[model samples]
Target chain A: MTTLHVIAHSPFGDQRLASCLRLLGADDGLLLCGDATYALKAGSEPLQMLQAANLGPRLFALAEDLQARALDGTQVIAVDYPAFVELSLHYDKVNSWL
Target chain B: MKFAIAVFSPAHAPSSRRALRFAEAVLASGHDIARLFFYQDGVHSASANIVAPQDELDVAAQWRTFITEHSLDAVVCIAAALRRGVLDDTEANRYQRPAVNLPAPWELSGLGQLHEAAQLADRLVCFGGD
Candidate 1:
């Protein structure tokens, strides 16, 4: 019954990230990719809030996206395509927040 | 496992192309595709009138052939498709449009169909939006 939520927009621009956050449940996991990787910058309050609110679910960001954005020391786990595939397989459903 | 795919970008968009590749890979990996739902600008993929230059890749055509070959259900959101001017013969007649562009095998449906597909499939994946 776990849902894998894939978010691809920046928190600063699109409301999708917020909507994703609001919809996420205790059993759901979050993966930040594309422009969303920018949210991992150090000292982002929203990012911190996301971390605090969803401790029961796993949080991840795309490593390739992070590298593209030059974002390092992200609080969320960095994952590659293989990890992405693994997550998709582990979860019962995937809800892409696009 | 059964999967339902949602495409949220136009056929010409890079993300749309990527979605095709992903779906191909999933099928090659032996997964079953329950449905391919087209939402937002992705409804363009169902338009039969789409024409590409001989040199460029005809994305819509590719989707048509693939869907036909697999006997997959490709559902385009009727509301979204109408707003975007992608219409089937029935819709065209209702609206008195000059032409109908939506082709066979790609059916116009409501969002409820997408919801049903999500519930029926083991996984629901999406491509290209936001």
Candidate 2:
């Protein structure tokens, strides 16, 4: 079954992102929120890692969080909380890395 | 849709508030909540000892009231709770502890309950972690 992996930690000091990438299925999705949104920061190693993951359209972030952090989210789909709730139903299941 | 929500952050943390809001939205949209599982530091949300400062929002109280108003099944991981000192009266008596921080509407259960809820739920949405 396809799963939506939600992460909220920093990619700089945590291993959840790397671990998630390893187990993410072909149709699975990854949603970055809170500090996890930092993964979309430009020219960062985590950005490179995410780029290599080739998540494409499946990559998403909470728009408000990105905005709060002043991080550009042009590289990924940015959704609000309402859409976040909608996405929980869009996938077969949601696995929050927390 | 049935959602099994798991909370892993402490009561004072931001994510726990987010989890509460998400659960509120889930119910507002006419969805069913399979279970509310409090693990790790999230078990503190069920504690009676949480005293929020005057300026801060009382999220723990909000969570308790929400569960009671909706008659929701709120489960706290027994292992996590015991270690974290979030004990019901039974656990308090069992452990010969004098304090009881857990109360009604919040049941202390094993981790297996989370798995069972997950099995029965359409989606398992978790909040907070290290």
Best-performing candidate as measured by TM-score: 2
Query: Compared with the true structure, what per-residue lDDT tens digits does model 2 show for residues A1-98?
Result: 88999998999988999999999999999999888988888999999999999999999998878998999988999987777888899988888887
Residue B27 in model 2: lDDT: 89
Q: Is the docking of candidate 2 incorrect, acceptable, medium or high quality?
A: medium
On residues B9-112, what C-alpha lDDT tens digit does candidate 2 reach at each position? 98888788879888998988889999999999999988999999999999999999999999999999999999989999999999999999999999999999
What are the clashing pairs of model 2? none
Candidate 1 per-residue C-alpha lDDT over B12-60 given as tens digits, one digit per residue, 9 for 90 to 100: 7755765676677668767788899999999997789888888889989
What is the per-candidate TM-score for chain B?
0.95, 0.97
Q: lDDT for model 1, on a 0 to 1 scale?
A: 0.81
Clashes of each: 0, 0
Provide DockQ values for all models, in the order shown: 0.34, 0.60
C-alpha positional error of residue A23 in candidate 2 after TM-score superposition, expressed in Å: 3.2
Instruction: List residue ranges in candidate 1 displaced over 4 A.
Output: A18-27, A41-57, A61-86, B12-15, B49-61
Docking class of 1: acceptable
C-alpha-based local distance difference test score of model 2: 0.91
